[model samples]
Structures are given as C-alpha cells and as structure tokens.
Target: MTTLRDIALIAGVSGATVSNVLRNRGFVGAETSARVREVAQRLGYRPNPMAQALANGRAPTIAMVFSDLANPFYSMFALEAERAARRRDHFLLVCHAAKPDGTLDTAYLGAVAGRLSGGVLILGSDLGRADLLSAVPNGVPTVLAMWEDAADHPSLPCVTLDFREAGRLAADHLLALGHRRIAVLAGARGDRVSHGARLEGATARLREAGVLGGATLEEDSIGGGHRAAMRLLEAEPRPTAILATNDLLGIGAIQAAGERGLAVPRELSVVGITDIWLAAEMRPALTTVDIDTRRIADASVNALLDLIAEPDALARDALRIVGRPSLVRRASTAQAP
Candidate 1:
C-alpha cells in the first residue's frame, strides 16, 4: 500500500508536511501543497480516517437519525442534508430509527453516542427517547429536525417548517372551494412535530369556518392513507375533500378514491403536503403544498455547523428555522360540484 511517507519522499517534502497538506491543517506554501497532493494522488495514498480523527481529537463527520426513510418526505430532507454536508466538506452518517412497529429503537442511541462528533441531527423523536438528549456529551452540538420544542434539552437547536401553517393552509384551500366536509389523513400517532401541528391547524381552521367536522389520524404511508380515507368515505356524509399530511398519503387517498369509482375534482378533492417529484406525474396532477426540501436541508447543515462552532449559543437561545409552504394549484382540486 502506498503510504504518506512514500508520497512525502516522492514530493521531496517532510512526512509532517504531507500530512498537513492532506488534512488541510497548518499552513503550507501553495506550491508545496499542490506538489504533495499530486504525489499522494499518483501513489494512491489513502489517509487513514481513524488516525486523522485521533490526531485532530475529533471526527469531521456528522450523524443524521430519522424515523423512516421510506417516506418520500423524509427521503427528500435526507438528500438535501447530505448534499449540504458534502458542500461543507463533511461526511454524513445516517441512522434509520424506524422499526417494524413504526417505533424508534433505543439501542441505536448507544450507537449514536459511540460516534459522537461534528454534530447530530434527529428527526421525529418521542418522549421515550427524550432521555437520550442528555446522553449527548457536552460540546458536541445537536439539531432536532421537524420538532416543535426541545422538551428538556433546550441546548439542542431545532429546524422545522411552519407545520401548523401548512395544516391551516390545506384546510383553508379546501374550505375556499366550498367544501364543507373535510377529513385529514395524519401521520403516525407519535409523530408530534409534523403530524401534530398539521392536525391542529386543520382542526382549528375547520372550527373557525363553522362548517368544521372532524379529521382522522393515520400513519404517514400509502396503506395508512388508503385505510383512513376508506373509513372516512364510508361515513354518513362523506368528506368532499381530504388533506393528507404528506404526499405519500395524498397519493394513496387518490388511489382509494379511484378504487371506489369516485371521480376526482368532480366528486372529491385531495390536497397533500410536500410537492414531491411524483406529485406532478399522477393521472390528475396534484394540487399540493411545496416544502422546499433542498432549502431545508441546506439550512439544517448550516445550523448544525453553527451549533458545532458554538454549542453554548444554542443552549442559551432557541433557534427556530421556519420554511414557508406555497400552494401549487393543479387539476386535482376544483370548485365544489
């Protein structure tokens, strides 16, 4: 195997100089740095990450933990975060917490603790895992994605969209079209941040409009959405419109409507959050809310970096990053028939 010593000898520089060039540490002349890099590349000298971490007393890698990656909504967010991390010359380690029963495994907490460095980003946490916040060693910053408040851990920064506003917007759009009866397809029961805020916003809007009925909370999946919509459709006075918490549920609702031989827009209108790629290609293009996943991801990585720089700053103040949602009108919604 080609070693740093070999590269340094070929580049006519000291081994320490080569190490500095590779790690971008201690200043080296531009010409010397370039020569060292070329020699290292030609020799295929791969720097040992473990040695680098030990020498620097830290790892230049961040960790991201999410409830579920299957949901396109979360997938988009992950992609954005990954891109942003890469841009900053950092590595991202993702941890999937979604279990078969849709609950987080506490065992992963130990794994996350073991790789502590750079920072940590958590999505969709619950009270059961609240204790894990304390496990984060002091000085290692953390960011909570899509959570409303950082329960006992005020030290952690939070980055999330205005989920309540998203819900209200969905309800308001349906109500504006003269649809008195509406139902909401919610995410998992324990998903407090995104799902809770959305459901509250919808319910509040419905009540204010005076034509408010009720909503059905379901999992954030196609199957869950189909079942929720199916039950709502079987009600005495079926809803004329449905507000799905995410695009996956919204698409599933549309599929359910088709199976029941119902005509979309002409009979029922479906609105979904997160205008993902597939939304536009549906049989009837969906009218949904656009949550700029890329922007969110970029902001999240920046926030994590900021936290790493000043972990105490996050502990002293709350950082709430809110992203706006814009409605994309399409063939899926229309005036009440």
Candidate 2:
C-alpha cells in the first residue's frame, strides 16, 4: 500500500498538505492540490480505513517543544521534523517552552506531553534530567532530542548525535591546516543547546596536540561572535583560526575578520559545528561539522511514534542515537599563513 509519506516523498509536498488535499478539508492552493491529487492517482492511492477512523477520532499533532526556535538550527530541524511527522500521518506542534530566564517551563511541558498524538519530543533546554523526567506524567510517551552529550544517558528516550565528535572534527580540521594560534569562541551557557560538551571535545583535541587553545564565552549568535572575534584579533599574537561551537558564531567571526581588513583563509581561518544551511550561503562558506540535522529529526519523530506504539518499552532506558558529525571543509578554512 502506498502510504501518505510515500506520496509526500514523491509529490514534494508536506504530509499535511497531502492529507488536506486528499480529504478536501484545508485550503491548499489549486496548483499544489492538483499536483498532490495527480500523484495519489498515479500511485493508486487508497486511504486506510483505520487511518480515516483515527482522523475522525483524536488529536493528530505531536508536540515538538524546543528550547529556542529563534535559532536557525532549530528552525532547520523543525522543517525536517514536520516532514517526518507528516510522513507518519502526524502533524507537528512547535512550542517554545522556555521561560524568560532560559529554563524549561516544566508546567508548560507537563500540560502538553503525550496529550496530542499520544507523544511529545522535547529538544534541548537548561532543565535537569530529573526535572525533565518529572515534567511528563508516567505512561505518557516522550523523547528528548538535540541533546549535546550522547554519553549522558538521561532516564528518557532520546535521539541525538555524537556532538563531542563534531567538536573534535572541527578542531582536527583546523589543526591539519597548520593553524596553531587558534581561538575557541564558545557559546554562552544555557541557551538553545549548550556547547560545553563540544567545547570539551575541541579543547581536549587541542591539548593532545600540545596546543593550549584558549577560549572565550560569547552569546550563541553572530553578533556575539563578532564581538569576541573583534577582541581576539587585537591580541599581541593574533589567532590564525577560530573554532566556534555553533554556525552563527562562526559566521559572525568571519564578518569580524573582514571588518578588520583581514581576508578569510588568507589571514584568518574559522570553523564551526552544526552545519546549518546558512553556513554554505555565507560569502566565505564556513568549514563546519555536519551533525546530520534531518536524520536526527526523522529518527526522533520515528522514535516518538514507536514509543506511542510500545508503551512497555518505556520501562527501561530507551535511546536511539543517530548521525555522526563529520567535517565539511568549505572556503572559510585553509592552510595557515
């Protein structure tokens, strides 16, 4: 049987759009609706009786609560996740469950978990595992995602990448380029996903190579990188390379280098982790570690749906690790001068 996802993959439309177009419920533009219908017909599509019954019966959206949606990385993952959930016949509800001070709004999380679509996937926030576990009532399926530390097994189901490896890859790439006077511009604590684990991996790799790479903590934004890089460039022995924990910071550093009259890869080199799409579009494309965002999102949604199906599996720890961070060396990095 051709699933909605199968049609979606072929049609290049969202699962929700396919559902809406087929059911003739939501308002999809004529051109799009026609295309979806045409694909459905070609595939000899027939709706499952049970699926139709479920559509008439219960909530259809799975909540994807994030620490901060403002981050492009989260938005990128959101797109992938929405597609993943739609493929499974589940709509995605994105909730920013962060308080003003940047902590998980446990009350908000408790209110939404497993209530819709019988599952929820929470991304990284500044909440402790105990607090994170406590938010969702027992028997409600939940999965944590975008977790930086793959080794810190929380007492909940999760889908994460080896972030430490991502950090190490960034450092190794710079080291191989003969950039020794490097600066580690780390993201500040507790906003979006923390980069401490990634930082640790990079610093560890630098130490192993006998280079005591100094670090600076800045907000995990391009502006923050600009500020830190502007200062770092002023030092007596300027850093030839900078390893930002996130792509935003790395881009900022690149801009800062340009403002200082330094040409990227000629006088200054920079690398970042989490290969957001923007990294490639930048003037000097960033050299960063690809964490495989779409894979994590797809795996996370699949894991949440699995939890909904197998309630008993929640008795023990459940972890579904996906994605390996590898270096994507773009124009931003080159051999040290």
Work out the TM-score per prediction: 0.82, 0.81
lDDT for each residue of candidate 2 in 176-277, tens digit (9 for 90 to 100): 999899999998854444687899899999999989987898888999999999999999788999999999999999999999999998999999999999
Off by over 4 Å in 1: 5-54, 98-107, 112-117, 125-138, 148-155, 190-194
For model 2, the stretches where C-alpha displacement exceeds 4 angstroms are 1-58, 125-127, 190-193, 314-316
Residue 131 CA displacement from its true place in model 2, Å: 3.5
Residue 159's C-alpha lDDT in candidate 2? 81
Error of 2 at 110 (Å): 2.8
Least accurate stretch of 10 residues (summed lDDT) in model 2?
Answer: 50-59
Question: Residue-pair clashes per candidate, as listed?
Answer: 0, 0
